[model samples]
Target: MVATIHVPVLVREVLSMLVVRPNGNYLDATFGGGGHTRAILENISESARLLAIDRDPDAIERGKQLAAEDSRVEVVQASFDQIADVSRRNGFEQFDGILFDVGVSSDQLENGRRGFSFQKNGPLDMRMDPTDGKPASEWLNTASVQSIATVLRKFGDERNARLIANAIVRARPLSETQELVELIDRVCKTQEVNKHVATRTFQAIRIHVNDELTQLRQGLRNAFELIGHAGRIAVITFHSLEHRTVRRQFSQWVDSSIPARMPIRGPNKGPMKIVERGLAPKRQETERNPRARSAMLQVVERVQ
Candidate 1:
């Protein structure tokens, strides 16, 4: 078997915050390369069980192989947003802990064919699940300038959203990754130190193509409902958008306010409590894996 080069970011910190329990049942909601799943299996007892879920078919295949080797692991092919349904169908009503390592995985980024890397030339297909949804190229070629600008501003936080969007619309029918990169490089001046000129555009496109933010919101809600009392949920997000969503959701849970709707009506105060302030990678980890630099981990425990 070929080895997976994907090193899970902040593995040690994630494990520490997860507080794996012997014989406990857990869920690895993102199960990218099974790094976190393997660690959990090692730390827990033989009686412990873990349910690994991933939307990517390739990831599911890898997860199935991993599960075949260990009786305690069960791999499911589904998005993390469907956690509640997947777990229910799998006979797990509540999980002792749930973990989400959001954003694109290393495997996706490194594989040029996946079209996630701006440095590598490839087709403009950025869907996490290549089997479905509109490819980035298709959307980029057909989407209006205003729509493209909106995505860049909302998802990528690109300062030159209008300029980049105009350029992209003008250069429609972009079929390759390099084409888009070159266009962005020509249109936007990169002032951010150590960041690529195409970074924001690529990020914006990928997030939009994958419907990531919406999925994350749903996943968080489902995960909270499915966690057992005293169980914890840890999320590692790489960008401001994701981190903001998690922070708001966690705050709502802590404050027991439904937000924009009527206050949570019940004797129950809330199901979640923040375990700690947002945590970032230490100098050592970031030095080893630069990708870990932007990662922010936040943990919350479910309480009655």
Candidate 2:
């Protein structure tokens, strides 16, 4: 028997920000479970077009099934970081709107084969682009202990990162999810055992393997460039790290400054402006979809 899948964190909020011209062009950067994509297509005019992108091949395939009947929706297999290239190649020269539902999907977490969950034991592989990227297992085996600890501390904010890193290093060449979980459990002194200590470690590893934070930075920048005048960009970030990146990037876009200077270029002066402060899901939507509980939606529009 198949279980039901919950739609992602801020569907309604995203729709409110996007879906500008029913006939306008839109892009779904994450395309996880096609929840937002289906809604956008259903509500928009027949002429409205959607370009959905996902690095995970499984997500791309799933989106294909959801969009099979909608000729207006184009599904592409690629990371959201490649937003500019994908949009250009697909002839979406400039978009009316773009939505980024960042981070992992429920499909990946629940599906043990993807190795994203602690509920079901699986391999430690967490590459979103499994075709071209290195898996989490390979990284753990090869990374220095200090590097591991830094990722755990920076990404996961795991308090015992040093100890966890030491434990992981001692257990060299760890293969499965359970092995890492067990190693973390062993090193942790607390007996409460409320949840797996490896949860944060796993999250850190997944973020590193998938290059999620970096992709988000680039994707947002590309999005700012790709949106047409008055076009909107909606981002739904699940966790604190993802939220922080979105917040910082959007904040920079709002104030007309770059958060971090890059050698390639300095801040671009533009007419982009934050239309409003961030919004959260409604009480009803949150109740209906538990995953929506943590979602924070922020919108920005290109102003002339």
Candidate 3:
């Protein structure tokens, strides 16, 4: 079967805000489909070096292929949160541009065995790095009702979090995505219209299984440290939770609200400035890629 390739969203905006540099070091923290990486390469010079990192083995292999084709690219198999170590380990102590495309890819959703899509009947495994961490099924089947409910509420904002959690506990050992989807449908007592009732639950489970939010938060801090003066950090978030995290972090990094006070370190990390508060895909781009509909880009640059 031909796998669906994930088209990068807001390509023009990302390139504009990020690759304003004239041949400088760039990093793609989540090289999902290599679309953004390719776009960056096209905009950069022959002397410029770009590093792409991904936790997914499939993406890493694709990155390796791209690296082979282009000597300017270096592909690494690591989580985005490990940006600091990964960067220094590969001789990239600082960067002119950094991108964090946060969320799952179309390829993962289309592949049933990856267990990220509610429509697919794959095993309930949602770890971005399948080799590491426990599967979603293992957590869902074993976690307490309160724990499950908390994750649903915190990550997915599922209104019926407690109700769904209770139902899941009653129907123990959900091994398949369809099984969980059916359970959520029965509990919600509704059918899919604009969006599936199981969508939020699946997202919550996936996020919890992968510790995504924590990874993103840490990745943001690491990116802030790794970015050079005037270097831009652009983040494309797919969910409201991720949007909030990026916005709050960027705001704190800028700290525009803080009064004139001592230079003691608090939430305000110096040398960062906000470039783009919130940028969404244009109508034409959204039409071509529906996944870009919910995407929001936030950019911040370091200014010494």
Candidate 4:
């Protein structure tokens, strides 16, 4: 078996904010490698309970191993978007703290078979839940040119989305990772650069394949609803769009009143509030884990 490469980002900040109560109930929305979950458990007492969710099968297996000796830990193999359902089924109406480490795990990027990284040669598969979401190869092979362009543009902020989409369409049946990368390289005119030109294209496809933004939005709302008053919810986002979405949603939830559209509509007694401003990892954390460089952590609380 290939070794997994998952290094938790913003570990200290997450532990500091999410594990205040040793016996408190907590939720880890994205249990990538169980790194954050393990850290939280270490900081808590025996009575503390942790409920974690992961969409990846491999990650679920890893979580199983992590929970082998800890009966307090319950690992669920499901998307965090269904947090409300999962929590209720597990007999938890509310939690003391909730944490979300959004975006792909480092392990996913390192695993070439997953086709998440353009740097490696593999198939064009990039489904977080291979059992459900469409693969990148399938989307690229079947999607309309305009739709492809739109996804790349919206999700990756790719400027040459149209050209790239056309090129991808013209070069159909891109089954392998190299074929897609080479084609994108030709279209984006970044072949000379060391970085792969298909990076953004792949990211866009993955985002579309998994409905990541929507899941993130729903997961945030669920966290706000399922966490008790004064309970803190911390989210670590990797990209600008994801970070912006979390920040905006958290700000709305923490200021004035909860949005009407949010499913977790509490009474009009006034809005829940953020305990403090967003927190970024220390320079030392970035130095230790370069992946932490782009991590932005936003924390909110239910003031009511």
Q: Which candidate model has the greater lDDT, 3 or 4?
A: 3
Instruction: Write down the worst ten-residue block by lDDT for model 3.
Output: 257-266
- Candidate 2 or 3, higher TM-score? 3
Error of 4 at 30 (Å): 0.5
Clashing pairs in 2: none
Residue pairs with backbone overlap in model 3 = none
Q: Per-residue lDDT for 121-240 in model 3, tens only?
A: 999999889999999989998999999999999988889999999999999988998999888888897655799889899989888998998999999999988999789999999988
> Which pairs of residues collide in candidate 4?
none
| Per-residue lDDT of model 4, residues 1-304, tens digit only | 3245789988887887677678889999899888899999999889889999999988888888877879989989989778999988987888999999988998898889988988888888998888896788998999899999999999988888999999989999888888888887777764435445676788898899889999999998888789897688889888888988987887676544554224344564545555445577899988998888888887776767
lDDT of 4: 0.83
lDDT of each: 0.87, 0.81, 0.88, 0.83
TM-score of 4: 0.92
RMSD of 2: 5.1
* lDDT minimum window of 10 residues, candidate 1: 256-265
Q: Candidate 1: misplaced stretches above 4 Å?
A: 256-268
- Summarize candidate 2's per-residue lDDT along 1-304 as a digit string, tens digits: 2232747676666777688788899999988788888888877998888999998888887877766778898999988678899889998999999999888888888887778876688888887777878888888999899999999999888999999988888899988888888888889877436556677888888898888899999999999889998799888877888888887887766544532222113444645666545677889988988767878887787765
Candidate 1's error at 182, in angstroms?
Answer: 0.7
The C-alpha local distance difference test score for the whole of candidate 3 amounts to 0.88
Best by lDDT: 3
